[model samples]
Target chain A: MQVHVEVLNFYARQMRLLDALDVEGYAGTFTEDGVTDHAHRGERVEGRAALIAGAKLALPRYAGAAVRHWNDHYLIEEVDENTLAVSYCSLVTRTDADGNVTFEPTFAIEDVLVRLDGELYTRSRTIHRDRPAAAA
Target chain B: MQVHVEVLNFYARQMRLLDALDVEGYAGTFTEDGVTDHAHRGERVEGRAALIAGAKLALPRYAGAAVRHWNDHYLIEEVDENTLAVSYCSLVTRTDADGNVTFEPTFAIEDVLVRLDGELYTRSRTIHRDRPAAAA
Candidate 1:
C-alpha cells in the first residue's frame, strides 16, 4: 500500500515538475541511461541528457498557453521483480486566455520504470495521442 | 504464476485469432460489454458483437498480405481486486507478395481486463500509434 502511494506520488511529482517548467528536476526522475520513445511520432531519445533535451524542446510549445496533463486509468504491471510497466490515459489540454482549447486534449503515456536501490526511475517512456495519423 | 501465464496467453490468443482471421474467436476474449478504443483513429467500438463487426471490416485489409503482430514489453496493472490493466508495445507488420514491409511497425496497446468467475476477459482496450494525425 505504501509502495503504491509512493509510485503514484512519483508520477504526480514528475508531472508537477513539468507543469512548473522544472526541466532539470523532471529529468532527475529518470536514470542516467533513461530512454524516451515518442511513439506518436516515431522518435526515440536515448539517455537522460537526450530525454531532457527532447523535453525541453517539446514542453515549451505552449509558451503562453496553459498545459495540463490529466492522467488516470493507470495500469501498473510489475513486469519482473524490479521492472514496472505503467500505462495511463493522459488528457493533455492547452488552454488560451479565453479558456479555449489550443490543441488536441487526448494524450496517453506508457512507461517502464525500474527500481534502482529503493527508488524508482523511469527506464523507457512511450507516448501516444488519441487522434488519427497524418498519414495512413 | 498461473495468473500471469493466463493473462499473457489471453493476449497471445487474441493475436493468434486475428492472424487466422478468426474474428469470432477473437471477440470471445472480450466481456459481453467490452469497449475498444482505437486511439489512433479516434474511434471506439463497444460490445462484443460490435467489436466482431469492426474486426471483420478491418482484418480483411491484409487479405492478400501477411500480417504479423509482435507484442512485448508488457506492463500489467491490477486496477482493483477484480480489474486489471495491461500495457504493451504491439508492432504490427504487413508484408507484400515479395515479403517487403508495407506499414509502420510500432503500435501500442493498453487494455483493461476483468476477472469474472476466476477467468480473465478484456473489458476495454485502447490502441495508439506513434505518428502524426491524419485529417479526420
Candidate 2:
C-alpha cells in the first residue's frame, strides 16, 4: 500500500500558506468553482473569486498574532476513484491581545476532495468536535 | 479512475452512527487497531477497545440533546493510487439544558487516508476552520 506523496505535500503546502496568511496561494488550492462552507461562521463562499475574497477578509483579522495550526491523525474513507472522505485533528496556536499565546485543539474535519485535470482540489469541508477549552 | 465504493459506504455508516449517537455502531467503524484523537478533548484513544470506551463516555453527555450532523460537499485530491486528501463541512443540531435546540455550523475538516490491506484507514487529519454560531 503506497501512500500518495502528492497529497501529503499538498497538505503541507496548505499549512504553509495558511500560516503565512498567503490568501492567493490558499485560494489556489481549490478549483475555479470551488466552494468553502464555514459551519462555525455560518457562511458559504463559492467560486474562486468569493473564496479569495473570504480569505482576504479573514486572514488579516489576526495580524500581529502569532499562530501555528496543524492537523494530523487522519482517516480516509474513499468515496470513489475520483473522490475521498477524510477526517482529522487540528491544533491551533495564537497570541491574544494580552500577548498571551494560546493553544487550541479541535477535532475531525470532514472533507470531500475531487481530482480535476489530474490536480486535487477541495470541494467542501465540515468541522466537528470543537470545544472552547480545546481551542485553549 | 474508479472510485472505491466500499470506502464510501463505510464513511456513510460512520456518519450515521455519529448523528444517531449509536455508540456500538460508531465503534464498529474502525479496525481493531483504530484510534481516535479527540483533539478537543485532548485525549487520544488507541485500538477498538479504547475507542469504544471513549464513545461510551461521551455519548451519554449528548443524551437528551437534539443532535443533527450531516456531511456534504466533498473535495478530494488524489496524491497517488493509494493515498488521498479531503475537506468537508458539517452542520450540527444541539439541545441545551433548558431543552432549547440550536443548530451550529462548523469549519471544514481535512484529512489524509491510507489504504492498507485493501481497506482504507485514517493516516492523518487536520481541522482547518471551525466555528459554531447560534441556531438559525
Candidate 3:
C-alpha cells in the first residue's frame, strides 16, 4: 500500500516546530479548542490560548537544550477515511548545560488522530511501556 | 468525525499481551515479515521467528514489573483510507524489586501507520520531546 507523503510531512512539521520551540507554529498544530497534556507537569492545557501559553513557558527552560526523538516498530493497526489509531516506540535524547548528552529510555506511545477542517489534529494519546535509563 | 473502536481495542489487546507476557498474543500484532528494534539490547529482530525469540528473552526480565500506559493529547494529522500519521505523549511507571514505584518522564511519539494485506502495521516512527528526570 502506498503511504501518503502529506501525512508524513504534517507530522514532521509538527516535530520541527516543537524542536525549534516555535510557539506560534506549535499552537498552529491544533484546533481552536485543542487540548494538551504535559504529563511531566501533570497538567493539561486546553484550548489554543492555554496551549500557546504553556509552550511559551516551556521554550525558555529548554533554551539551550537540543532534543532528538524517533519512533520505530510502528504498527498501524487500523485506518479509515477520517481517523487512525497508531502505536509505536520512541527514543529520546537531550543535551545538558555541561555539554553532556543523555538519552531518555524508550517507551511505547499510542495515539488517535482525527482529520478536522482539512488538517490533522490530535484527539487523544496514551503512552505506556517505558524503560527509563536504558541509555545509562 | 467517527473513531474506530476496533483500532483502539487492537492497541489495548497488544498492551495487555505485553503486560501479561503473552508471547503468542503479542506476536500476533505484527506481520509475518515484521521487524522490531530492541532498543535496550541495541538490536533489531526481523521476521516472525526472531521477533518471537526476542520477546521470549525480554519477557522474563520484566516479569514482576507493573506498567500502565495511556496516550492523551492525540494529534491525528492526516488519515486516508490506508495511511495515517499521528503524534502523542506517553507516561510510564515501573516497580522495582524493592516494590518502590518510579514514574519516568513523559515522551512524544510519532508514528506512521499503513494498511497491508487487510492489516494495519507501522511503517515508520519519529520520537520527539522526551523529558528526562534531570530536566524534569
Top DockQ model: 3
User: Clash number for model 2?
Assistant: 39
Residue-pair clashes, model 3: 27
Model 2: per-residue lDDT, tens digit, B1-136? 2343444444555665665576667766555666666455466677777776777787666765535454556667788887767567765546443435455546466656667777666564454346465799
Q: lDDT tens string, model 1, A43-128?
A: 98888788777777876465654554556777888898788899887755454444344335577888999988888888988888
| Backbone clash count, each prediction separately | 12, 39, 27
DockQ of each: 0.02, 0.05, 0.06
Question: Which residue segments of model 3 deviate by more than 4 Å?
Answer: A1-4, A38-42, A77-80, A96-99, A126-136, B1-21, B27-58, B63-136
**DockQ-based class of model 2:** incorrect
Over the stretch A1-136, how does candidate 3's per-residue lDDT look in tens digits?
2223344555678778877778888777766776665454367777778878877877776767787665543455447877767666565557877877654544566666677777777665555534322211
What is candidate 1's TM-score for chain B alone?
Answer: 0.86
Model 1, runs deviating above 4 Å: A1-117, A120-136, B1-3, B132-136
Q: What TM-score does prediction 1 earn?
A: 0.53
lDDT for every model? 0.73, 0.62, 0.60
| DockQ category of candidate 1 | incorrect
Q: Which ten contiguous residues of candidate 2 chain A have the minimum total lDDT?
A: A127-136
TM-score of each candidate? 0.53, 0.50, 0.51
The local lDDT score (0 to 100) that residue B66 gets in candidate 2 is: 39
Find the 10 residues in a row with the least total lDDT in model 2 chain B: B1-10
After TM-score superposition, the amount by which residue A23's alpha carbon in candidate 1 deviates from its true location, in angstroms, is 7.6
- Error at B62, model 2, angstroms: 10
Ranked candidates, highest lDDT first: 1, 2, 3
